[model samples]
Target: MIFRQICSEKGGSLAYVLGDPVTREAVLIDVAENHLTAAEDFLRSRGLQLRLLLVTHWNASHEQAARALRERWGARLAAHESVHAPCVDMRTRDEDVLYFGEESLRIFHTPALTPCASIYAWNDRLFTGHTILVRGLHPKLHGQARVRLLARLCALLERFPEETLLYPGVENQGRRLSSIEEFRRRSQHGAGGDSADLLQRYRHLLPNKRAAKQREKARAEKNLHRYGPGQDVPASL
Candidate 1:
């Protein structure tokens, strides 16, 4: 099995690479536009073939990249029906299990269809698309439906083992990994709670004006490596 966490410098979004080393079949999750060069180099080096280019959510930052990568890799583009991307070749549904070689990924549809639209589970990791963060900063979602979403998120977190790693959509504090137990403990969300209360408590969650400024500052800061393992690949769109 081959697994990697890639951070796009443009949006600071997290992209993932999951592959069956034995079969040489791979999947790219929310890969970025600037990520193409490195991805190609790595795949070529490993002799891996991309079978699926899966988007947990169709965001502006990744749309062009996804399309370009699909064309370059000739991999099938997969997304939820709600995404409405004409480029998408596979309209995945909730609980849909997609297979590539000997590996499989189970998709779980979430409320926010733009950023945190879906969560994909592969092995012990959960690609939580923007729905989760190690900082316990769940995306600030409007609409009454988020109440249900919060309750559902709590339930989802409960179902997974404490050790299960969470690979969230956006980068948090330059980190790319967390766990169910660590999230529950650090985020101040205990076992179970009322959705309404959860909303009230975390209504101001996600990025605020201050956070945006922080990100801009982080953008100025540079990384040493270009696109090696665990490298933060920064580039403009």
Candidate 2:
């Protein structure tokens, strides 16, 4: 098995390239548009054929690259069932196993950050996108949903081995990796009932759907203004 983490220098978004060395088959996860060339180059250098493009969540920045990558490599695009992207060739469910050559990844639906959020487990490593960062859990979930999701997340975390390594979507605190045991210990300190109540109390602070849309629109406009027309905008923006 071959694994590499490709991180964006400009934005904090992270992408992964995992390949089965024996079979020469690879899978890319949470790919950003700016990293496409690098990813393709790496695959070519390794003599690996891209077989799958897996997304953990829907982000405008990287989502646009899915179609282009798929068309270029004939790779199948996959994501959680809740993700309504046209580029997705397969809608994955919790516990779904995705196979590429001799490598296989088990899907774990962790909706603490977003409803479409998912984590893929391969061997002792987990590709967790925006769900579990080095700092802690993402703080953008709905009120009651936060509690419910955290409970589910705790349960899921417990299921994994203590030594399992976690590769988060974004690197925080200058660290890109953590272990299930560490996260479990941290979670125990804050995932109690009080934290749930605190989250509920601050529910009003979370952005609503309209605000999120406006923010996205603002970002797109900003990108267009900054990069001008016909330029490939970095997905991190």
Candidate 3:
């Protein structure tokens, strides 16, 4: 099996293509809007036939090119059932397998990051899209949703083998891949973070339902004072 990476300049979003050398059949994972041409070129250059386009989730930034690529390459599009919009040819479930020659992909539902977020393990490699960042800094105010997501990530740490190689959903600051054991240590005792620390980063943002609404109300009033209506508000403020 061969693996290739395609990256987008805007967000460092990565798309992966895996090819079976014996059969020259390939599958694409989590495409970015700007990298479709590169994916096509990689397959074409290897004389491989594109068979599947799998999405890790249904975010527009991640999957806007699904229809165009499906039509162009006659590829079957797959995603989680929760992402029930157009362009998905197959709705995937955890442990479902997609075969490309001798290689088979096993999908695992990982709802920590988003409703439809998932992890795909194939040919001794794990392709996790955006559910865990190997290096990119998570935002400071992602709310309880992010807190819950971190808990899920901890669960995954206890579930998978230590040797499993991780290709995170998004590119790391510079690293290409990481091992599960490495991730475990990094998330537990790293200089600037840990699972509990990660959760704490969002604690203030994740108030109870009533407090959250109240916070939003206060924020709106604060914005009204600062922007004076019909004006743009700064994201951080």
How high is the lDDT of residue 237 in model 3?
A: 67
TM-score of each: 0.75, 0.78, 0.74
lDDT accuracy of residue 204 in candidate 3: 54
Residue-wise lDDT of candidate 2 within 8-119, one digit each (tens)?
A: 7876678999999889999999998877888888999899999999988888866777888888999999989998878789999999999999989999998766788899
Ranking by TM-score: 2, 1, 3
Give the local distance difference test score of model 3: 0.75
Candidate no. 2 TM-score: 0.78
- Model 3 sits at a Cα RMSD from the real structure of 16.8
Clashing pairs in 3: 128-169, 129-169, 130-169
Per-model clash counts, in order, read: 0, 0, 3
The deviation in Å at residue 38 for candidate 1 is 1.9
lDDT of 3 by residue, 11-39 (tens): 77888999989998889998867888898
Off by over 4 Å in 3: 140-147, 190-192, 195-237
Top TM-score hit: 2
**Stretches of model 1 off by over 4 angstroms after superposition:** 113-116, 142-146, 187-237
